[model samples]
Target: MRSRLHSPTVRLRRLAAELRRHREANGWSVSETAGRLGWRSPKVSKIENGESRRLSADDLDKLLNLYGVEERGEREALHRLAKEATVQGWWANYRDAFGSRALPDFETEASAIRTYEALVVPGLLQTPEYAEAVFKGAGLTDDAVSIRRLVQARMERQHILFRPPAPHLWAVIDEAALRRVIGGREVMRDQLQHLVNMAGHHNVDLQVLPFSSGSHPALSGDFTLLEFQDPLDQSIVYVDTASDVRFLEKPDEIERYSLIFGRLQGHALSAAESPVYIRDIMAGLESDDRE
Candidate 1:
């Protein structure tokens, strides 16, 4: 997870998004760009959309020339940005791991995040000790120093959830997660208490699905729908399995995730009552701990 957040290649995607804006404003079709570049239309579309893995400086020069960028300084900056873009797909190496890469980008631009978590409190809601304990339980073994560093990174990531320009976060947790002692009794109690504390914030809306809700949509794995303020920009779906993390794009797939989130939200406790519901779970956990 720490490895995923330290990537620099992700910066280039921001540059790519900028170039796309200029192309749209100029009303250049993919075929027109293809004609100017002496390449196929698909190539132009892929680079403009930040989907090109082997982007080159020469290709960037040709594309910018087609856009009639007369200023030398502006052109140079874009050239450097393109050169930097050639770096490895920041998230590529970790493609088989978790989807931590998407969170930074999402934190930068997402206006709202609707998450359906089936088995635990979201990472953003984890206490430092809870994060450390959960990582250990997940088999993230390390000496004292490595464990501290990893936990610190996870803690830093949580700042995005409470930053000044924070996005609206709607997290739906299942009852089973509330019941599970992820990091033993004490850590689980701390984690649940943290959830109750975060629920006090207006920007954060936390809801829990009780057992009685039974057999609703989203019995599947965990997923999150990230919506941006710019409607022209497409939304993203973050899906996590125990082994792999997938960032999805297809419109229909995103819609399915969104629809499922809507249904789960209905089954969850209301915003005002969510803390109350979770506190009850915490009390139950505390009682069991005493026994």
Candidate 2:
């Protein structure tokens, strides 16, 4: 389980990384920097590690001054980031449904999202009925109210798709996911239709990896790679397992996944053909319904 304390917002993470970079470039150890500021070592460590409960403007200014960051524009930008870090996003209201996970926070900041789904439709593309079915199928909770809340939260997450300057969503879904049939034929049909519809969105690119493609790189599991507009805000890969969720930020990890996704795209049907492919599957489902 992700600890609530350590799940800093994306802005906070960027701020922390910047501060750490400045300290390193100045060739000052954490203890030495803390000593220079007359502050405890842990305080410096926490701020650099993105574990601070809250970062004050005063503290940020002090750190910038020590680093000799005299450029007014740069200082003002960092100050804006510090202020933005403290503002709670709409996701905060849904904490009960999402726990302390920062996936939504990161998603909110992402400028482009590349995702590969092997089991089911990506959450951002799931319909309300399909989402409800998924939550219930996972046995995440027995309470009907909780399931409803989760479904609502999932739907709300999709709002980013429609917002102006929407992040581009490039999704490669496995054929197995399309054929799995969740929430009965009617629901699954609707879900497939939703995918086809979403593919038509200007910012969304959808592809289907048929089973016949066989022996692919991401045969292991699903992962989402989020890229931010700001260069300082590094890209991250999100992996969710039955037991836990992991965020990968290392350059090597990102590169490996990027390669895997590129391969997956190569194996999958192209954007132009994918919706047609889904419609074919939907035709089979309709045939099944009529039978």
Candidate 3:
């Protein structure tokens, strides 16, 4: 399990949540649990909160024992999860390119992804050249190696599209994103073409939220809603900011984002008409080139 290429971020979080629930169920406070286990309060807090960078199977065993989880099946299942939690995804090597395992980890287990981008193309749909321009433009780093690694990491995240039972991806991109020529005309052209091609995939739904639609929801910034296949896993909103990655998991927050995405989908072009909209933009770019 540790040898697997993908990070078990979801599994780790699930285990943490489960441990926290068990502890709370027994009426043991964090400090009480730590005192019983002869560990620091922060140590217990970190592991229970899924903030631990590395979790030991031994520690998990101790936790299971403390929580009075006796059933063989239940204990074994959790033990297996704890073991998988130690495994790191391929992106672990490119920490500079991508900070923290948050996004990649959530993406690993997401069964459906809803994205709304106002300023630029979604990373999954971006061409290599376009990705390079985005990375440089964002001022991530001037170093060539870091930029290359970042682009490669972004490209690798698209593999989920081809995986068996590919996750359903519905992307609502602003009209401005389609019109903006990033990395010059050739790059923008290729990027738009790729989006058109990807739209045809059975699991992919692409929409263009035209400028003519006027103002609507999601003016704050870009965000992604990740839904998991498992009922135990909670759906989450990933807010991507210039400085930090924020995750919203509260019931109200999830409902709010879900409604916003639905509204965006309603206002955007239909799946069938999106390609037409894109082709028109492509032609406009061509006319500018000719002039």
Model 1, residue 197: distance off in Å is 1.0
Which runs of model 3 end up more than 4 angstroms from their true locations?
A: 1-6, 24-42
In order, candidate lDDTs are: 0.74, 0.89, 0.87
* All candidates: TM-score: 0.77, 0.93, 0.90
- From the highest lDDT down, the ranking of the candidates is 2, 3, 1
Model 3, range 237-256, lDDT digits (tens) per residue?
99978678899989899999
Q: State the displacement of the C-alpha of residue 127, model 2, in Å, after optimal TM-score superposition.
A: 0.6
Q: Choose the strongest candidate by lDDT.
A: 2
lDDT for model 2 comes to: 0.89
Q: What RMSD, rounded to one decimal, does every model reach?
A: 4.6, 3.4, 2.3
- What would the per-residue lDDT of candidate 1 be over residues 203-243, giving only the tens digit for each residue? 89998888999998998778888777655557888877767
Ranking by TM-score: 2, 3, 1
Q: Show model 1 residue runs off by greater than 4 Å.
A: 1-32, 39-43, 52-102, 140-144
Rate residue 224 of model 2 by lDDT: 99
